[model samples]
Target: MSNLPEARASRNLHKTYEGGSSIVGVLQQYAHDAAPELLRESGVSFGLQNTLDGDPFTEATTPENRRASLLSLAPHTDEIQRFIPLYRHTIHPFVPLLVDIDEFELHVCEYLESRAAGDLRDGSKTLNQWLTGKGINTIAVILATLSCSSYFSDISITERSTTALKFVARAFQALQLANYMLRPSVEAVQTLLLLGNTLQNTGQSDGSWILLGTTIRLAQALGLHAANTKTRGANSRKKEALWSVIVWQDCFLSVCHGRPSGISKAQLKRLNFAAVTGPSLSYFEIMCRVGCLCVDLTEDVPTLKGSVDLVEAIDRCYSNALPHLQSLDKCRNLHQRLEFFALQINMSFTIAVVCRPAMKKLPPGSGEDHYHQFLTTRAKQSLFTTLRTFLAFQALSSMPLRNWSMLHSALTSMLLLSVWEETRHDPQSRDLQERLVGLLLAVSEESSSADTDSDGHPSYYTQWLSPRSIRTLIALQSAIRNTPPLTDHVSPTRSVETLLTTSEGASLHQTGLPVLDSQVPDQITALLGSSVAYDYDQFDWSTVDLSPFAFIDETVNMPFYDSSQSNGFI
Candidate 1:
């Protein structure tokens, strides 16, 4: 039992202009106040390189072979048509980008018609012609959808990844030709969202996170974040839905990477557009709420009180959303069931992540510390819920394994459980860890069998375990077998004082957040260090919402997707 250093209160800077009654002083004050907002609102670019209009579309560059390749992969119209239903069932239910399948199907038809007309009289078509006749945005979105849906296709794992990449390349080509960076559209935003998720599914989290910035910028350019009272039609609902997804990704990945989010709290609060109803939309809104709770922890000046308040809000949100889950459980088809489990896992994992910093701050010889004990129990319970729901998701379908969010949620919680001192020896925690290890080993063995079918080549199923995930699994296996302290694996010479002085550690401790201690085991630091965003020791939990549905939107109608009645493929 080491103790954390006292929380550091942040220093605030204020400037006063002399002669404030003078016109010049008042003007200076106003300029200082307005400059930051103007820069942010204008969407100015200070970068030297121009992503848009950098290269001209040429015969050699955007050659006919590119189109030939897209056609070769999906040559027939029916082949392209098949992706719509696949997307509706496999991707849309979770991502919910294409809320109306019929509307998207119409766009698919228009794209095909445009492609047909382009083929009639083209000898080195100009870029504008390519953009106009091909319906570049629509084609990009469709290709992106195919890239994502291919993950759940029945094809071999290798084929699934390769096929998905091919479509992704084609989608990029279409965007490049259309100069999507300059000519932003709702369709282009959808394309980027799908492709970003595809990148994540293929174990490219960094790339996906980078791509999200561009997606959010494009979404903002379209005014998707602003609430519109003039229009309440389907299109407006779609805009609000898309904005929710953007915020969700921004906040979610910010916490995952332990970095500052591009979306500020003011923006998040102002862009509160989760007024829609539907199973997927409701789920999306709640997920965004959970993501928002963790955002404060990752800010440059992390605050314990803010983070703790949000953690409790997250708990309340989970409690609030629970009845929504149970209400839908009356007709729990596979899709609804998966959504239920996914939401539960996401909320719980976020709670655990936010609560982790506080776990390390328990006072020495305070076994009688009821608050600390309750916090520890809450964190452990969250980790357990996350893993259990993850298992439920796996039982329903193997698709969860390929989803990046689900994979990270389960892995992060497991890593926390394995390294936390209190949880390492707990019988129930050990049992869950053992069960998880068994499942991983079983999946690895099945993947090996698939390799045998593939003539000794590595199976795509093996891709689900990224190098980082593999390392985590290996460490967990060793820890379970030996039950040794983490120090046996690696030596730590650094002190908590040294950690507090480092720029990264200091950032976490700024503004009333507790600092990490030197006495924390080296192994635990090594395991959970990267994601240790904030300290969370002191909090009043009495403020937590007691009402089941208090946080849910009252205007939302409870409409859920019943898989039995679905006409699309599942």
Candidate 2:
């Protein structure tokens, strides 16, 4: 699609000032007014008068066709039961959005029973007779769950891909049939979350991001963010749980895209992470804190704009989160440890973003360029930490490849290392870069042997690298091979194995020396796979083109900031 015309005013100025801050719609309107002709050529029709020109809006499917499509897309009740457990195993463990699983199952059983009774009463029945709007919405949620779970099933790659696509199509059609946007429900929001997450995992991040925005809006409409005494009970718990996932997703994706988060800080404050008290914090509670810190680090939008220094923001958030990170170290369960691995990478990646603007050239003969030096060091160290933790995560588990956030973080960190001249050439960063490249190539080769898409190319997720990203990695590897290693390198006295066996929970400084700070937490020690020591007091913490009408894949290696002009870096 053609790029929209550049706005004469700031994009933020386009907010609607009613209901919610509808920035994107207003901006699109601005684009239409400014250059309708250009947009017309790019397949964007302007007015209702142009409906005859084959506008997508004008082409609506009849109710009969819609019912047929939903039926074709939906699997049998037994199949749905099978997929639900797969979803619970693979996706729900990480997200945990669909809290009322028993209720959802009840809905499915009731719908099936009702449909059977209706069919017996009459040989022919309308769509509404078979399923109500709410019923359809329920099925949409089921289909969305199936769409995501299909990848992890023990099916052939071709069958898996086809099945997933069918689920996605059916889920989307069911949502329309249910009029979910017009008459929203808890199930509607759940469906959106499941479908959005499915799209994200399959490399349709742009669509996934857009779907999340809609989910947040619908969630607000349902008053999920409000912590009211009247809204107490199982329903309230479900709302709060769903909202947490929304906050986590909004903050993380916002940081990744270099955009302001849809979930504001005030909204997050209302959730009150402090009230989530327990002797041992569950992964849900832990994830909420991680999400909130991400917002604290990067989501400073309508507030003070450029007045708050990014470095100060990073420090403040990191300081606040140190205690939580420390506490997480005590967790020994395999599940919680996996959660910690995700938290560690997310924290490191978020901090790296705060320092990304500073990843430029240092001034020549400057003794006191701490601002540049500090941030540059942070960006490199954090990016390296992200890659290193991700590597450790992969070694420790096999299912993490299905963890979309980790995969995105790993690919993104590698992309930054490939593009950022400073860390790209740093001797300290080369070993991890080489290791990551080798791992990615191995994954790609593995996928090539078993999983080829319709185009005969390895599926992007299975291959674990986009073509552009892979090329960049190969070039980076070649550069690393040609570059001479630093002559002043010092070998460590203790190997990782010795350290692991000698000390159960030892905190190593950035220099690989064990930290003697009695106050420092063991969690910080085990945060990264590397020996890099970070002081909590000092630092901060925080395309596929498969089809013409398909969503665009994420630019996994794109820079956090679109332009260096904003940060004054050449």
Candidate 3:
């Protein structure tokens, strides 16, 4: 296939805009003169007119086919530019090196420009034409862009919502071009990890779980889990960094979902922890360690309740995590602060997991009961307080409105906390939830999107993709299939009812943990296996009904954590 020549800008158009304005100004001018929104959304045609001179897919592959792929996606350069910053801020704090922001922008800019003054092939050729842009470099850009749009949670919607959908469309196309199954490159593993995150974030947990499993296997086959730095013609440091992220996500999500971690300790040890030092990286490593503890607490229930050995081990792990929190004090940036928010929430979650067993079976009417009950109470209080602190920060921070996963997780905690507050009548908890809820609703309303066609008009499908789920692109899915977004319009009474209502659409006949607790008030149950409700806080989650909450002490982790013994962790 012969490569098509770049489109030449009209001499008159260039004469008027060239060096006369900033990119934004030129873009606005072009917008008024450009094709309609539908054509833009459908994207510039790269079909027969741009096909390889000779059916490159059927005949031998050629540079022309790669050129075709690059040109086909050229129209999206604006969106890529628009969302890249948001993605970097919202999602890149932990893995800052995933994509080279300036380099990618420069490369993409050249590809998009067809002016007589510049060469389109100059920076664009740096992309691996060998893989036809299905390689890591290209896929990373697509993943970063797609992730900028939440897959699952309903964040506030906006014109960016349409841009998000467009990126998703491009991502699907990019994956197809990558020949994902046929040739799994090292960068492909990161691409797969990112895509899994997208699916998981967008509320496709079932699919994401399956995709992650495939990713784990592929990563292992490629020896990505190993510490080898000189092999595979890849940057060992980069590979190690990728491995760290993959494992961290694997462990953390696995614990959250009550599934086993796919990359075991043995697998992790093989990935040499290169001398990585920094507040953010250290904090992430701490999270990975806590994820390991969560697995032990939830999945490995071999010891008898109140076993001295079991209690000590749990205490040791919890205490070990306290010092890691000190690392946050060293962080002096917004991204680090937001990352701290995630860690803080996860700490409460881990605390609850650690102490849950103490609640499983208490010796009623015995001194032992009081001891276990005290520990359990302290743990529960820790969970509530940590959640409240994070939520308070989240309300003032403006981070959640931009981060889908953060918002999603925060809301899930809010939903649970709201119920807790209702029963306990905690004014503090109520205040926190109320502030967050209002902010969430406001953002949703502000970002509401209604994309138009190339004629610069809206159509039904475009509206459907957005309409409601612009706050909920997941709404693009079947209402019956999705857990409906917690919308701003839905009143509190109805909202609770919607969430707590039995899923005639889904089923309770699933596996492991009190993920969706039974409606029982203040009690614990073993879901994957059967266990009795504890005497302490003897309410079953399964039996909880919406009602006025009683006021309770939302104590911080102080009572459960002793800084002196926490090995200076706190």
Candidate 4:
């Protein structure tokens, strides 16, 4: 279909504005002289017309005729110049009117499609030229109009009665034309950011990320980083500032895209690690992204290489940024950098533990074996140091709200650490296990104290113990149980019971663990196999209700109750 004739005609108006004359001044004069009569003819309130004088047409005119009249006049450069001043002053009041500009654009596009070729084509060229001659502010207004149109086309509101979608496309096209005409100006960056924000708001995260990526590159090319280089005190600092924003944008996009694991790979690759400032900021952003992605367990682990690589990159950043971090002058940014580095390190530890079992093993003495060993050891050490630092920092001051998630994450890491220790017979593993147990106890105590219930149960602590955490804790205890008998260590059964009763314990018996008389599903029973044994008679089943604990009952199609009243038997 041919574009709107009125819209094409309006293009001539844009050309007039682009002629470099005092368009705003001219528009204001025109509005003062002709607005009253125009208002009467358009069937709008004189006051509203006066208020809207010189302003661009928007969506809010009350009567259909008034709105159409305003839009029809919007493309006329001569009429626009006369009221430009009044329009500028009353722009805020006309914001609602702008909403339906998309409808007007559509009307024009449709009209141009049927109109005389000269009027259609000549009008667009004229508006283009006029707009080109105008100042950045004029350009912004034009672009904003176009953006409003695009927004309407992309979104739908069932609650409202209006036809604004058509104009939306035209508005965007107009804005695009303006953007091309004014290349390299800060306006271009603003336009890109606006488009990115629009795409983000509409749930087009990939599109947003792509636009943001382009903006970041352009911002860099234009030397936005150079302005802050002096305050950053190093070339590296400037790069860090630049990459930080890019990483943050990517992180937000990744989070919006259902926490896709490898979404940030392209963004991460663009980071300039050579710059001092860039490393810290880049690492900080990467850590935050990884942490967010980890919590979104819906994401496939196999698609998480981007997150894994991000962690590895953070380690490299830590190595490079640590020396600068030691100096008090750079300590502020350094601390933040380390904090996030530590976070990513912990994430890496968790990912390694989850992925290692499935990972392909290397041949004995092969370079791959050495590489794997190095990663495993580094991940473990990083997890420990990061947790210690994080805890110490928390103890010293009021930590940020987001850091609370880290505590839960640390507990999970401890579980992984125990698993690692069991797999490898390192003597220091015992010390690490002790530290992890202490940390878990402290965390549980803190949680319990903060939210004790009427029944004296630690609700917060219980709630925080998610199924994943429960499984990890059980695995850790089971690992301890499987350890060979030592000279002075207590029995595995006693130790396991003690751990289950500790502050970290909740629903231990209900979580398909090796509890007495608890019916287990075939899958779980298969998992248990002949490795674990259950003594049904060891527990006084008469004293407790085991109905809710039953997974499957063999004798009957339903669960058997112990017929106890005191234990709140289900």
Candidate 5:
């Protein structure tokens, strides 16, 4: 971390300023801080070339054709009008920007007013019509709308999932022509955030993570991260909000995706607190704290410290964060409560991620005393907590939240619980395992029940509840019930680690999910059907102690989608 470009440049610049106490020192620091973004996004000679493969909007040949293609994919004005506000009310709280509700409403009204004047096809024109109407107001209005559809669709809201897809494609089209990263727009920073968000939600987080770097870089170029004082107005409030959003999101996703956060802790201290007030803001601060821990482990582990010190570092950072993890009732409003729950899912999942590697006493290719049993216990504790918390969120949420991060956390817990049941031979473990699986199945059915067809059958999430995951849950229960309790008659020679390919393997062979028949990802099949031999004698780890979430994120476990088949309006 000390040898990274940002740190080194800052060190040299400070030396040039002779202990860095003068105005020249401050200016140099600012220049040093903003250098990464400029080099990354500006695409200067010798810098890394932009790599955005198969991005729909960027593939278009010419500007005219790009607009035409984008126009061809916009969603209905009515659907956008309906779901965007629901998203603002629901998902927005988790990623709150300094937005004026009244102003946004007016923008929607203007688009509606255009359609009310006369319908292009049936009742309203596509969003592209408004874009073509002129003025930059369209970008601001559309990006907010895009935020709704992108996120909602990802959570399997069938009603508008297709609509969100169209809007996302359109947004990137607008971004392409605007030269958004190098130049600026009226809402460039906000637009970049929403764009990355849409990609993240749609299981394209690699691209989303890449886009985040560009967004943070551009935000810095605009001086959006400067310290703020008491006397601030709406514009100042907006910048502060944007800057906060960049830092919180950059750090949060960096942890999940295993990347370096551009903003260091020292850089974090440079920005004053956001010029806003809300219970959501308070929870946002908590998330930032957890994110910093993630950044620490991502950079430090395996390189800066050995396994034992790594466990202690986890304790020092995350355990002391107990006070920050309060009940949802502490929040003032409904949005804050929801956002707080989302934070809980993130924290628990992150802990499981950080502590998982230490669980295996003798992981593949390790020294004699390779494992820490205490860290293994901590991993299981965090994982079960993750399951219960996600179930609680489902029971409480009126509608299934459409955030990708939240869903991945839920899925991570589900997979980990299944793995735990397969390996453990205890009665209490079996009982608790059955209950959790039942709860998850019920939660999935209920959450997906919201968007149904004429026959009252689910439409969207039906596809996400893959046969493999569903059967894995059911097989876990049966495997628990039918497998004989530890008895003298049963002389077991097989190791628990091999149970993955042996126990679940035989069951999966019987269940015959399409993955077995089709070209499903090897990662999932390898996980469920193959077993890596481990010396169970050396490690006192339970089934749940394994790090299933390590390989999974929003993308790995997410069901496949074909954006080209979208139900377009224009």
Candidate 6:
């Protein structure tokens, strides 16, 4: 046995040993027993044993079997330190052996030495080979690794300083190459999404966006966007794969700072209702883009309108998208996407309202007047109606408390916009005032009907009312009511006083059935009275509060909407 080389000896032992145990089983047993002893004897000096008395078993044969055997033995506390170099050196010559080892082991080996980084590239090539020859564990492993790295970057990057973005970029390129070399796999597209998300989180958004954009192009190239196919046949599978690619691409584009290239009108046309699984995901992407564009209040009206048009385009493509916003189907996922859409619409409406004064001044071109007027009215009314519907839906549906906060912030912002719009036109002001009264009444009714806690107080609105929303509402109201009068550049003291009186009086009388939070009404009054202007160090909220309604003044002191304090909505 010693005269025969190690490979031939192992082969002979396997052929000769005819017990109940298989060759694999016996090898496993031997490796288990020997690995610990080998480690103990070698101590700190063991660096990857490459030749096991060299009859030279195929590189593929020993690494997997030996690695398994070593694992079974559960060597010393320093098992990793001992096995890293050994596994690395042993697997070096065998391309197939690289594919057999698991990703975690690969990661461990890479962590042990920077030089081991080449193993991943080697492993990827091996996987490509395995996928091409006979579809087996390699494809699965590749998909799993991609997903594991994408969703759980902290785990994947445990020992590496590599950013999740760069890792995802590498994974995308690998998957793309694999697709070119092997059969198209849904697993590959899904892995791309995982990589996209990881890249987004790691601030390599540009790289991720470009990768996703390329994926969309690839899908289109493969005829994956064929609209007439929806079943599990070859055409349908291809289409489904392509749809996922497009959705992920859109998401990446929507979230990243700069727009990705390659998405043309033709591509957008392909993504109409017929090609998508549901409009929710695509709508969400459009909403994200809209949000990013409209966050800055000072952006040009045309720019804001461009954002609005993008959302409208989505709405046109997926007509059912808006109606599904309040539908109680798949509540959690539906609510999340709907909430984002709702916020985008509300912000767009605010933009329209802010731009209304400018709209009136634009010189009338042939059809521009009608178009501009329609946009102004339609955008505001649609936003208001949608917001009201959302609130009503929340009141009826057993949504989580966080939903309430979202609804509240939306309502607050809508109210502010309506009031601002009214202030712009006297006739519209009365109509808005009436609507505000009715909304307040509905809120009051809902709050009263809701179950109170042990302390007899309703749940706090913190879960929904993000700080930014609160600040936006305050600033919006401030802007509308305090706008310098057209007659003279007078201080906004009178306007502020009028707003304070009207709001306080409306709350006191429970006008139009307002949603009366006893705390909120008081807080609004106090904030109006106490908040001072930066220019004058004087307390503006003080003079505003010295009314006959002192009780109302004392109660309403806190900031109404926390999010209002920021640079408006985003």
Best by TM-score: 1
Per-residue CA lDDT of model 5 for 1-570, tens digit only, reads 111122123221111101245443344467776675443333333332333312344553653554555445444576665567665666665655434556555666665565556532332334334333122224444654665545454444564555555666666656554445544433666767776776666556678789888877777656566654655888777666567677777866776666678776665776564333333335555555445445565464452125446546544444433233456555676555666566677767776766655543345554434345555666677777776677667676733334667766665555555444333444444444445555545555565667676866445434454333444445433333334334423334343334444554565455442112222223232323343332333322333243444434322434343222334100
TM-score of each: 0.68, 0.63, 0.57, 0.36, 0.61, 0.36
User: What is the Cα-based TM-score of model 4?
Assistant: 0.36
lDDT of 1 at 403: 85
Runs off by more than 4 Å, candidate 5: 1-76, 97-103, 110-134, 140-147, 150-159, 225-233, 262-266, 274-281, 302-325, 328-340, 354-380, 398-401, 416-465, 469-502, 505-570
Model 1 has an lDDT value of 0.57
Model 1 Cα lDDT, one tens digit per residue, 1-570: 011111122111011112345454455467776675343323223231233332255444354654453344332466576555677766666666654567777767765665566542335343233334134566677888888887778766666777777778877776765467655667778888889888888766678889999988878766677677777888888887777778788777776766678876765675554443333335766776766656675674333444466677765665555444645454447767777777777777777766554555544786535655555677788899988888878887766677888877876666566556567557777667656655765565555455433445354434345222342343322333233233344224333233333532343233222333332223222333322332222111112222111111110111111123343110
lDDT leader: 1
Candidate 3: tens digits of C-alpha lDDT, residues 1-570? 013222232111111111214443345466765664433222124121122222333445455675566456433545444555555555655434353445445544444453222333435444333233323235445544455434222433334444445555565455545544443445456556666655544444456667778777756655567666447444665666666667766765664455677777666566554343343334555655545444453345333344334445544444444333545675577655666666666655555445544534444565566556655565556546565655655655554444334544454444444333222246555455455544554444344333345664333222322223222211111111223333434332332223333431132222111122332111111110123322212222323332111111121101122112342111
Q: Write the per-residue lDDT of candidate 4 for residues 1-570, one digit (tens) a residue.
A: 222133234332221111113343344456766674342333223221122312243433333433233234233333222323232222211122222234434533433332333332333443332333122223343444344333323122210001122232333344443333323333344445445543433323356666666666555444443333235455445444434444444444443333443333444443443455533433343443443333333244332244345446545544444433323344466344444444443444445433432233344565355445555555556556545544554453323111222443454344444434323334454444455444544554454455545875433224323232233344434433343333334443333234334422333333323332222222122222222432233322222233211211221112112123233211
lDDT per residue for candidate 2 within 383-425, as digits (tens), equals: 8889888887788665556567778777667756754656655
Model 6: per-residue Cα lDDT over 288-407, one tens digit each? 333333333223224334535644653444343443443445346644444544444343444443344322333445445545565556545644554554545345332211222233
Lowest summed-lDDT stretch of 10 residues in model 6?
11-20
- Quantify all predictions' global Cα lDDT against the true fold: 0.57, 0.57, 0.44, 0.37, 0.52, 0.37
Higher-TM-score candidate among 1 and 2?
A: 1
> What's the TM for model 6?
0.36
Cα-lDDT of candidate 6: 0.37
Clashing pairs in 2: 314-540, 318-541, 509-533, 510-532, 510-533, 543-553
Count of clashes, each model: 1, 6, 45, 56, 0, 36
Question: What's the true lDDT of residue 483 in model 6?
Answer: 40
